[model samples]
Target: IAEFNSSRKLIPASNTKLISTGLAIRGLGPSFRFSTRLGYSGYISNGTLHGDLYIIGGGDPTIASGDRMTVKTDSLFAKWTRALRVAGIRKIHGHVIGDGRFFDGPIENDTWSYNDLGTDYGTGGNGLCFNRNIQTFSVSPTTVEGKVNAEVTYPATPWIEFRNCAVTARPGTGDNLYQFNTDLAPVAELRGSLAIDKGQKKESFSNKFGALTCAWEFAKYLEKLGINVTESPADIDPYDNIRYTEAWGKDSTRTGFRYGNMAESPENLTLVYETKSPSLKEIAKVTNSRSDNFYAETLIRMLAKKRTGSANYDSCKVVIIREMDSLGVDMSYGAQIKDGSGLSRHDYIAPEFFCRYLKAMSASPVFKQWLYTVGIAGEGTMAARLQGQSESLKHRIKMKSGSMNGVLCYSGYVMPSPGKPEDDMIIFSIMTNNCPEGGSKVRSFIDGLLMRIAK
Candidate 1:
């Protein structure tokens, strides 16, 4: 119904997921599923395996995430343990290796701010992701009034050391705790303060070494199941391996070298079991609804790998541009896609692009599935928004919201009336950058505008 500065590019924040998720739905299909495999590199004789046990990653983001749509960690580990027992693997004579070479290059986008790198939402996408690539800690204020106690509460991170530097603040001050650590760092420092009245709370931090963490957790689970593993869990760091570079060099076309091709594994590797992730449609729903950065990044990487034979951020950018062009969405007007999740301050796109993209998606064959993935009233990021509005009005508004320091954006479709057909839907995007107003005020303004539109 309106247009203002629509062609001007601005920071999109998590609204970038709209593009990433759409490309994923179009390129990978709604029914596509990611697979992670458990196999051994050596011969199993009697009751002992002579070589490393491998968890070959397929870049599945939902493994052990404990979401309503995904499996829990302990249950998944138990299933793996049972599979090992059924395979007659009473003992492992070598290390449990996490082979995460499915997706290559830096785990995180280089443009992402360092401050965000340590937080749970800032966690990078990784092959063989487990527990959503997050490490949770239980923190409580101490009796000393100035000190707090914190400890790792999940995935058994024996390899990591935590130094609690958090303090106890006055009542009603709330939790201000933050974790400081680099990617794959063994040490993490917890800094900030928690209100004494808040008691204990759970804080989450990014887990960059997802593959290694997964292997470590599984090895520990096996030990608990009376199965002995000789060596500690280890991960294959693609950046440090000479063979990785050689493999890339060998594949001049960069095709058939990653994702599904397990050429890096030993020829005699024995398949134990394989796990399949929820469909891409389900994953996209979670991504858009929750604004999940990890899921968005992984989906884009998977899309790049499928279309371009490479999974790095650069390849993902290329694939996105090509796909948008195919949809006749002009991105030439100062659109910059730095990362799939829009975690990077470098990502910029015009409001027009979002509307055009939404219109294009609405015309797609999978439009219903894509529409179902978006957040509605009282759901995901939209749960607390439009509070006083009627249920019918609220339900008529479906969109994805994006917010950061001074950025707030909403992009999606608004039904013209209750039970309206798809053709009658109105596509819209509102992007605000460097707004001086508080988030709550900005959100209220946006909500009012959307309410009017819905009516």
Candidate 2:
């Protein structure tokens, strides 16, 4: 209904997920599902496996994710344990391996800010993501002044060492704690302070060692079940070829096994069990509704892998451009798509492109499924937006919100009326970058604009 600086390139923040998600639906189809397999090499005899048990990651992002749409971690692990029991294997003479070489790239985008790299939302995508690639810790103030205590509380990070340096602040000061750690580092330093009266608070930090963490957690779980694991948990490392070859061997058994990339399993690997993720439709819903960076980044890489046989951020950019071109959506107007989740400040897209993309998706074969991925006025990120408005108005506004630092953006379709046809929907995008105002004020302005559009 209105437009200003529509062609100007601006940071879209999490709105970038819409582009990745749309391409995923168009390229991979809504029914597509990611798979993770449980298998073993060598032989099993007398209720013992002589070789390593493998959790081959198929780039399934939802495994052990704490989202409402996914299965619980313990429940999923139990199924794998049952599969081992059913196979009459009670002892493993080798290490539990997590093969996460499905996607070949750096976990975190280089363009992402260093500060964001340590936060939970900044967790990078990986072949075998567990617990959303985050580790949580409970922080509380101690009786001693200026003293505090912190402890790891989830998914068991026995490999990680915590160096708590946080102090206790005055009452009503709230939480100001921050976690700092290098990529794949075993030592993490907790800095900042917590309020004395704040009681206990849970803080989540990024986990760069997702694949190794996955292996370690599963090994612990197996040990709990009386399964003897003689060796430690290991993840496939590109530089550590000696260890890789030693684990699987270099004989005729290594026919289909390729170093560095394990997308294709070894020929002699016996399939114990397989875990299938929720369908792409369900995943996309969670991606946009929660603005999940992990899901979006993983989806884009999966698309790239499916199209060009390479799963990396560079290939993802190529696939996105090609797919957008196929849809006749012009992105040549100063648009830079650095990462799928828009965590990078370098990502820029004209608001006009979003409107065009949304319009094109409205006519797509999977339009109905794609529509379900965005946030409605009273749901997800839009829960508090346009509050106290009529239900009709609230339901008609279906869009995704993106906010970080000084950027806030919204883009989606606004229904013309209740139960109206897709053709009648109004596609819109409002992007605000480098605004000095607080998020609430910017959100209020955008909500007012949307309410007017709904009316």
Q: Which candidate is the best by TM-score?
A: 2
For each candidate in turn, the TM-score is: 0.90, 0.91
Alpha-carbon lDDT, every model: 0.81, 0.82
For all predictions, the C-alpha RMSD in Å is 6.9, 5.4
Give the alpha carbon lDDT tens digit for every residue of 1-455 in model 2: 68898989999999999988988988999999999989997789999999888888899988888778788889999999999999889999987888777888788888999778878888886688788888888889975356689887886655556678889988888888878876444667888888899998888988877777788788878988899888767677654331222222123122112243343363457898988999999999999988999889999999999999988888988988899888888778748898899999999988888898888888789888888887788888768888889988888888888888899898998887956775677899999988886778888898899888878
Name model 2 segments beyond 4 Å from true.
143-147, 171-173, 240-268, 419-422
Candidate 1 to truth, TM: 0.90
lDDT of 1 by residue, 327-436 (tens): 88877764999899999999989998888888888888888887888888667887888888888777777788888989999988887685566578888899999988
| Counted clashes in each candidate structure | 0, 0
RMSD of 2: 5.4
